[model samples]
Target: MSALSESRNPGATRSLQVVATAGHVDHGKSALILRLTGMDPDRLAEEKRRGLTIDLGFAWTALPSGQEIGFVDVPGHERFVRNMLAGVGPVRLVLFVVAADEGWKPQSEEHLQIVDVLGAHGAVVALTKRDLVDEPAIQARTLEVRGRLEDTRLAGSAIVACSASTGEGMEQLIGALDHMVGNAPRPDSTGRPRLFVDRVFTIKGAGTVVTGTLTGGPIAVGQEAEVLPPGHRARIRGLQTHKRSLEVAQPVSRVAVNLTGLPTSELERGDVLGLPGQWRGTSVFEAWVRPVRGLDHPLTHRGAYKLYAGSAERDARIRFHGASELRTGERAFARITVSRPVVLDLGDSFVLREAGRQQTVAGGEVLDTDPPARPGPDPAARLRARIGLDRATLACRTVIDRGAIRTPEIAVLAGVTPEEVAAHGAVRLEGWLVAPDVLQGAAGELSAALRAYHSKHPLRPGFEVSEARVLLGQHHRVLSDPGLAEAVLGSLAASGAIVREGAVVRLPEHRASTTGREDADRLVAAVEGGEPTPPTVRELVAAGFGPELIRAVCADGRLVRISQEIVIGPTMLARAEHLVRAHGAPPGLTVSGFREALGTSRKYALPILEFFDASGLTRRQGDVRLLRAR
Candidate 1:
């Protein structure tokens, strides 16, 4: 069937990406790949003459079942380990190539460690150059390699002896790869299309073009896409997979796209192309990094490094939390702050190299693409929080449990296809959805806290909204969903769970008792009879009342603290009434004038004036205060 026909047919299964071949220099990796795919992957003349791949190469083969399998031929040289890492990020299967004559090499082991770190779904070992080794020698070497792989994730993977020159085991290698591909999971086609740009250049007539194995979703000609980090939008003018022009390309297929509108200067090999606004450049992320086993030095904080992910490379600073130094081969949670924003999703694989030395130090999976700003205290706490959310479903639930999880954040944390998470629930394209239970639980906690607070400070008018946020801590912003919090507060008030007095929140019982008490009565009497002066806290306390009770009365609006020694209750009402009648309107009163009017000193007058400012009884300007409208 035509590629397009196979993509559309219900019975035709999606293809798989099988990344194979490893070992230091001249292992016949390229030759074996050429024999399998019948396509020369080594296009560079330097690679042809040197008989080794210096960069990543791609080739494809159609299996007996009509399923297409793409292979990523990565350089085995120690210097190009970064290139190997870049190619492994999007692959599901590994074709580990070991030369029978050369046995195992350093780069081969390093490459295998990288494949394990990347979490390849499956693997097949090719013992190439079998013609150079006798049958017994080949068998012994293959067994030794198998023993070495026993403790690894690729332990039980199929191993086949082959010679690219004689093509002895070519059919067997194809069969093994095909079998693994059939079992590999299919990529989700739903969501945003993201192609990690592995190769970028201008075709003779196609303008700026980029090629990479389609890692997620599908892209079609004429579809609009955006280049990330730099964030330039463009349209797909052409599409090709496996060197054949096609209308559309699906996941696991090697695709080259000719783009329009984006200048060649604006595009780069690492820049990811995706549906506009589907992905974002991330500055902060949480990762569970493992240092390469058997290294002498420990991973240190603020250590500069080069980070590689899906054909993208950038400089970054690593902050190792929970410990000052990460021992060689030790695993720890780390926060990576990139020098600039890069398009990254949750579960994406990344390699870290020592900044200037360019040696692979560590590699890890992304846990969070955009983590909340965390400063001070134990950095390990943030790491643990991320570690607990390693599972996709649990992570998704945690986001829901926390109230709102951004779609992009969910995609980054779960490592599942972005489209799958986006389809799991109907969330606002920009805002996340909070589960009803989470919202209800937060509201309940808020109400209980307010009630407890009112019980402790009966004289206080209510709880301020800002104070409530401080008390809630991490749940603060999650609950501060504008009218949502207010609605909960209102519900509590209506149910007598709490009382709302302006901006203050109080217990219903406390508001009633404080306002009806005799201290309130005595305060009113003292203020009205004492030459229009307000009663102070001390003066009110002397009248068989506590300072707390006096403050409560003032907060209830039955009395006002006009001065330190002079508290007014219904007394300001009379003065306000008199002033309005005599002057047509109340005049602006200075601290001196307010003191004279209340017959108190400046010390007593200042706080009372400010109290009026808080109550909206007067507006302060410079040193003067004006009576406010009722």
Candidate 2:
């Protein structure tokens, strides 16, 4: 009977999970898996002759608990660390193998570090070769391994001593697997499937077959897919999960795809097959880097490094921002300029290896998938907000940050064209698409600032355009840019949350003060209420009120402004509209004809007539003005 049967069911069918084995060369990771599942992970003849795993080996078994588990047996030699990384990238658990006789090893530490960087957090530390070591030695070695894991993602991992030769503690290891598998996270169904090709080979009659751990979403048989970077289209002719034929393979599970489109020679390691339209490979991206564990040195700026993300490894350079060098144990922002295009999602974890060093210097996650060549200053701070915000909110914040971003930049943020962004409920001003919520947030900001200003100076009616820009910039850096701030203000005005008059902005509730209000009332009284010609700004300013107050009255909708000087109150505007309606026809009233009809100077009447034409209330033909349908 398979040793897997020695483990008992927890009473129900359990979760499916993948776990990788990592340790030093010839430390019995393969033998241990062989003992546990009765299947040899080492499939290569070269590895069989050399007695070492030269490549990743796959095996699986069903525990008595009915939990189906897959194992990716990774080569433990330092030379195959990249191969090891590919196996460990998508696994939910790491079965960290530390031989009891061999004790702690360097390659084991490297494997754990890669696991941490890729965020495959949970681990089970196996003290293998227990039969070769006495109890005291086994306990000491187990404690040493535990000490190595302190303050890490695997800090709380269960440690079990097991020997493939004598089977000592094998059941305990399987029991631990049963207990932990239930807590492993299921695959994300974000509707975008990604299978980073780790192995590519041809099958008897199945054509080209590629295998990797599936993630992000599901890949079903007969699904249309594309190989990224190369961007060759394909159709999934067949699907296999854990060696069993499947109609659809879910994420976090190992999958082998039979594809039709490109030949087997065209595929290679590090190629990604995904749902085509949702993603594109980019050569440049931004990442927020943090130093590796126990690395007590700063990272050099503009240094070339080897970066491993998913199943792809590429040559990359770090362009550190705000610092010449990144100090050890400190977080820094940097742009990852890759030699090859890679399909990366925002927040995907990656490991960075120094060019000439044996140790990995740092690791980070992609912060921006397609960042501008020069990300604006304080990019890390801006990116952090986006991590928690929805795409539209981030797009809006991007506009706020840099005043305005162009269509291409908007495409980077919104994942669509600026026109598409607007079509999907976002607001567009000029050429910039604004987050619908941003408009409200900006209005609230303007309203709040105006409210504060009113509280400080009750006599002031509103914020002058220049003053409003200052206050907006003070409220949010994005608001400080005149173009974007005006866009926000313009949106607010359109929504009627604030009033925009001449060169001033204010909340709808704000009004000119006690003296200014009474004087504006008296100025309107002096204008003939039923006449076409009205009092001018010069007359109002000479009477008592200032030009500023008169402008404020016009902005607050108390008066109709005809020109710089010619103005009329709402009562007189009603009489002038009455005269236009009295001649409302196809060949309406001409400027001179209206002037003669109103018995007024052309200076006042002409501006009023022009205002009517411009307002869409009347359409003029040569010298005639026709009233538009109400």
Candidate 3:
């Protein structure tokens, strides 16, 4: 409930959008923003004295469509990029400034990388200081700037040459912005929001104020919210959107929240405020990472770097997966163990920096914000593979980046239902749901693993069913799911690609029927040619057959081993079974009675009776036993 909506009579809803500025130092970004918004973006005395933007500034204006637009004016210097990201990260549209007098420069390239890495929709290029350069020079600079933007998300954006002093070509810039606001998605009205704290300060009247872009859902006045990372609880004493007091602040709007129960000094620029259970602070997570172009060297495992996410910057240690070293041009799955607690969302885009070099090395999209504990297949293997946004319009992209998701978390992640996710090609497997591509890739990896294992050890019965799950996990993470792996292997078995024999899984062509002509004949003679009872395994070993070979033959299903010292042919066991069924007493089938009835001594009789019980063929009670129900 916005203050207007909660008023005596609410009128038709109106939309307000935000945009940020980015460019090289001295590119006249501040000049352009001031010309359009009628406010000086350089508020700090140091910035005014040095004629350089050392911090972020805010201003706003109305477009021709009567849409109120806010501008987050960011610093153009490379040293202040963390501050620039704090501004641009919360806005979708950008006013990319390039001074015609100086042309493109270094910070321009770095700022543009941040734009692409953060996943902004589109930007409008502003060729500033056109008054200082000639018409041909302006045209030449425009061509150069567009060429630099090639292969980028904003390559196709509209560019207009303008002079803030003369106000030339201002209307064209307004037209481009109007088109963006019309096409930009609307904010979600759901009452769950996470405000990334960018600016925190104190006013005499209001105890403490924190401001950022309100995303995920809506926040109402008097709503209880908690500061994350530290999880300090607070109450929303007041709310302001675009600097006006509002009872409720909607998603995607620039919001300033009056908070109680915490001092302004305790709250910093990187803290997050949200309702309980909607978000949590985490120190470790995983993402699908891609190194940016032109890196001097490879990104190796366990390398520490500076991570810039939303408005927060923290030192992070990277552990590359799929490979120990990530090639510069390749994308790989990696885990990041940060030194600080940060609120992360699935599919959030972030920029990582080599702090010593002051250069951005790689950027990635998060795959799992809340990962399940990966207790490795072998507890000792220590599989260290510990493997945000937005309101309504921002919500859909969040869910897609999240990969495998649960049904209940959909509403909080994307402001939609499970049905909506399924309609978009997500599939349900076991207890979780994942995108179609996840299932496809997992199936392929698991199938390939089975082929590899069979090729290496064809003589083995097959891979143990449990070991198969672990082997697949060692390669691709998504296939380690027990239920899904069971389902996949079971499906493959039904399709004849593999065979399942109790606890073991093997290729369909694998068999346990016989070892060979030599071993089979010897085993048959030993059991059938013997009188009354078969030779024990020790006697067979003494006769020249190795223990392993004899055991393999016994396991070949031609004979049954009742105990370490007892072995019997399957035919003889059937005769003994028939005798027990015909004469073994229901009144009391004692061990002594079975030994005499089967014409075998007590040594073989008790072990055979125990084998029958172990196989569920009979039951033992007190000093007697009886047939078990089938």
Question: How accurate locally, in lDDT, is each candidate?
Answer: 0.71, 0.76, 0.74
Cα TM-score per model = 0.75, 0.66, 0.64
Residue 585, candidate 2: alpha-carbon lDDT:
84
Which candidate leads in TM-score?
1
Q: Which prediction has more favorable TM-score, 2 or 3?
A: 2
Model 2 TM-score? 0.66
Task: Sort the predicted structures by lDDT, highest score first.
Answer: 2, 3, 1
lDDT for predicted candidate 1 compared with the true structure: 0.71
lDDT of each residue in 1-630, candidate 1, tens digit only: 112223332233244465656666678788888898888878789988977788888888888978877778888888787777667766768888889998888877787777776677888899999989899999899898998787677999899999999989888988998888888776655356778888877766568888886766777777898888888999988777775666767776777788888878988777888887677888888788988766678778857898877777888988876777787657888889888788877677788888777677778888767665753376556455655443445455445545565555555444454344444442332345444455556556766776776655565556786665554444556556554455545655676766677777665665645544555576667766764444456765776677777676666777765655666656555564354234323456677766676565676567666765776767776666766767
lDDT of 3 by residue, 1-630 (tens): 123222321222224677889999998989888899898989899999999998998888888988888888999998998899788766677889999999889898888887877777768999999998899998899899989888777888888999998998888888888887777777544555778888998767667889887776777777788888888888888777655677677677778888888898789987888897677777887777777765668887757688888777899888766578876678777778788988877556888887677787888877655444662343112222222322332333333344455566766544456665666566654455565565555556656776776554433567788987786555445556676566655655676766788999876665544454466678668877773577887888898767766666565666678888888888879987887677545775889988888788888899999988888877898888888756
lDDT of 2 by residue, 50-121 (tens): 999989998888876887888999999988887887777656588889999988888878777777777765
lDDT of 3 at 375: 22
TM-score winner between candidates 1 and 2:
1
Worst 10 residues of 1 by lDDT: 1-10
- Against the true structure, whose lDDT is highest? 2
Off by more than 4 A, model 3: 1-14, 185-191, 375-630
Question: Candidate 2's C-alpha lDDT?
Answer: 0.76
Greater lDDT among 2 and 3 belongs to 2
